[model samples]
Target: MPDPTDVEKARSQRRAWEQNELRDFLERQPESQQEYRSASGLPVQRVYTPEDIADTPFEDIGLPGQYPFLRGPYPTMYRARPWTMRQIAGFGTGPDTNGRFRYLIAQGQTGLSVDFDMPTLMGYDSDDPRSFGEVGREGVAIDTLDDMADLFDGIDLERISVSMTINPSAWILLAMYVALAKSRSLDLAKLSGTTQADILKEYIAQKEWIYPIRPSMRIVRDMIVYGAEHLPRYNPVNISGYHMSEAGATAIQELAFTIANGIAYVEQVAATGLAVDCFAPRLSFYFVAQADFFEEVAKFRAARRIWAKIMKQRFGARKPESMRLRFHCQTAAMTLTKAQPLNNIVRTAFEALSAVLGGAQSLHTNGLDEAYAIPSEMAMKVALRTQQIIAEETRITEVVDPLGGSYYVEAMTNEIEEAVNRILKEVEELGGAVAAIEAGYFQRGLADSAYTSARAQASGKRTVIGVNKYVEAPQKDAIEIHRNDPDVEARQIQRVKAVRASRDNSRVATLLDALAEQARNPSANLMPITIELVEARASMGEIVKRLREVFGSYAESPTF
Candidate 1:
């Protein structure tokens, strides 16, 4: 490390240069924005210098894959292999989605992400009156193991990684996945994928919750423990900040609250007698890459650093793999504007670049038409092409941590790391994530930040090209919207009813009764029973109904 006195001398000289040379130049040409701040509201300086991070030691910001992985998790990173091109795909029936999945895979997509419709996300059968017209409207509807089997038909589970984006009812989907793999005679140990089973985030932001908070957490804990024991190659829970960011959280709140949630999960599993290292290595994260390019990059760096320290120091994690934080990223859907939809292509490119520069392990770029509806086939292809252009054409993958030593990037990384730490401290004082969540601390913080952002946009403080500053004529007719088949609901209802009728009612009842009996025990692991229920052709609604009886439904408080 360099001497502190030498660093101070260099900083003093730089300050003199700024005062004498830069000040006179700035008087003639002012900046465009009156106040500079990140999407997270951290102050941005006109210029950064070594002095800004003089106290940050070189050892603290070490080489890639090292402890406190601020630089990058893997030393070679994209140089060895570009980030996994995972496209989020779903809309219509399982077979419909399976076709789209095959299309993307043939188009060079390396991984798959499934998005479930509202009813499936909420654990409702397509035949439920509550489902009505919502069946397969927003995403694919998976009511049973047959749907899951169709979703991955002709595709090898042992070869491809699939990420299912369903919460509140995530365990049901995982069970269906395991049962489908068994049907194919594939080893469960060979299957690799992630289930977005982070139920805590539902209460904090998305609100797609079913059971009460504590009981829901119990289900998530069961999944983690079961996955560690059986599905060694799979990530049972993808603790996500993507939804929180989409719901309008500042980047800092997203990182802080997410890490706090991870802390809570580690504690929950450890309390079950599983060591932190046993499960922490499989614990992956999902985050959003927003419009503020450099800030988003810095946020990713700070996130890895913070998680490394937390796992190593706070939890006393022994393994290096356990401490290293790995995450997947998606471009911000909230930032896309329907007005000049072509502009979203450029916006997504920049956001994707931020994730790459920040060392994302996998990424999904939002389609140009995503802000309006499910992407058309053309739009989805264009989105995948965008990532291909970045990975192949840009030549950014030639180096690791390409912007590691830049003054502005380094200073911003330090600033974000400090700010996120302070917020984590606050969360800790509130008795960890669950307590903070129950008290409405995380929710209120996000709400306030969202309000501030809305005000900024409304008052012209923030310039969103198509929404606020750059006016444009409406092109509702010109944009091609991907419409779900009108008969989808009727068809899904019929299929579900057929499956229910074919199964023996007596055996279904016995399995459900056993599930309820197990739910009554606080120490039971729910995955084994869930897998059995799914394998028995038990409908999603039947299983969810049984668990709901044991773990009552949740209703959020109006105030929070």
Candidate 2:
């Protein structure tokens, strides 16, 4: 039973309306063989009317904080509590990252999202030979508790939520976060943050992982079980689709694969001795808001509906909170360009608006200067201010899901939901996300989409403002790039060496031994040992190295 008000209103509007200006202009215009179209190859009509979304429901497409959550996760959303002003940053060493964190905080960033270098992701200490030339290169290198302490030196861990974009070695890092907060005497139960412990997606898309799929799932299950009982306020896994999009997925592919991955993780944890209603509520997700504004908005809406359905129908999620798909979205970093980079401000503004409209829990906009290097100080401020202005100046936030009843948006939402369900069916036919990953289902899909898009750009079928449509001479004067503090690695090494010197070497070894024992014995829950190691302030590398010994690293098959 669909609500009839919107449909009836649309009928009346279409019956009475006239595009007189369009009719006049077309009558005087010369006929041409060429035709313009949307990048997705959809026709560009002169206008859309209520006739477009005439069948949409006023109730099913209800207000924010309600079922379907087409509007948003909360009724007041940003009006009640503004979206987290989190900026992605981490580079050089611990102290270097700490300084950058402080700088972003000063620039009005509401939260911290840490990006780690290769060594940290691979679970290697900075001085390890395998980590040569990699530590502290692209993102911060954290190997020890001293590094973790330095990473949040002056910042109060309880006040601001932290998002650590790390997996495979997530447990070790999460342990360090808990330890640091404990050092500040912050309540363990009240610690706020999320760790990117989504290792299944590592196998699916990102490929930054240290363990085989099954062992990794076991580790993730343990973290969920542990976080439920221990760090209740902290989210254990941020099931991410941002990397999938960066890996060249179309918007729908990102949506389906990410949701399917979430399904897989929830299934695994549910099989664990814990109740489904227990930890599912703490789960969080990360997604990328792509350039197709309406399409992206629809994707978010569909995701919420699909997730709610998945939780209720599939996982038997009883709590409304458990059924809700709370997520953090960042603008597509892949869309930002080094050419006419200033135009990225315009690019980011629209994407940010789309995120707000789609009802994101929080968002991170890429810096205008990101494509070239870690954004300069000024560039970061502009990015943060971009979100602030949209929040403060734009009254869009005052209304929850203002576009909810729009014909095109609701239609697109249904379209994407159906497309994602079809893709999920195909994925299931290949034996679910992990098996699909093993078969390269996701990888090949993305490669095909990327190839198609690239060809379109090359043939000028798609218009990317400056790149394809409006050609302009390149802007002069390179963006100011931030350099690695040359002495950072040395300082980090000294800090680790000193911590290792002061820590009880025997106790550290004993805790490391216990962690190794737990990893070796699959039936043993590692949380008990991890909490002990965390309480002792064991370094991230020390714990990760022990797990690496047991579970071993993964090697992915390359694309043909």
CA lDDT for candidate 2? 0.81
The global C-alpha lDDT for each of the candidates, from Candidate 1 onward, is 0.90, 0.81
- What digit string (tens of lDDT, one per residue) describes model 2 on residues 1-560? 13467557766665555356555666799445356443333444445666555555567577677765656767788778778989889888877888989999987888999999888998888777787777787789987766788888999887889999999888878877876777788898878889989987777677888888888889888888889998878999998988988877787888999998898888888876677889988999898988989888888888888888888888788887787788999998878887888899999999999998888888999889888887777887888899999988988888777777666777777777888999999988998888888888888887787788888878886667778878788877757777667776666667667877787888988989888987888777786788678667577677877877888878888773
RMSD of each: 1.3, 2.9
Q: For every model shown, what is its TM-score relative to the native structure? A: 0.98, 0.92
Residue 167, candidate 2: how far off, in angstroms? Answer: 1.1
lDDT of 1 by residue, 242-286 (tens): 999987798888998899999999999999999998999999999
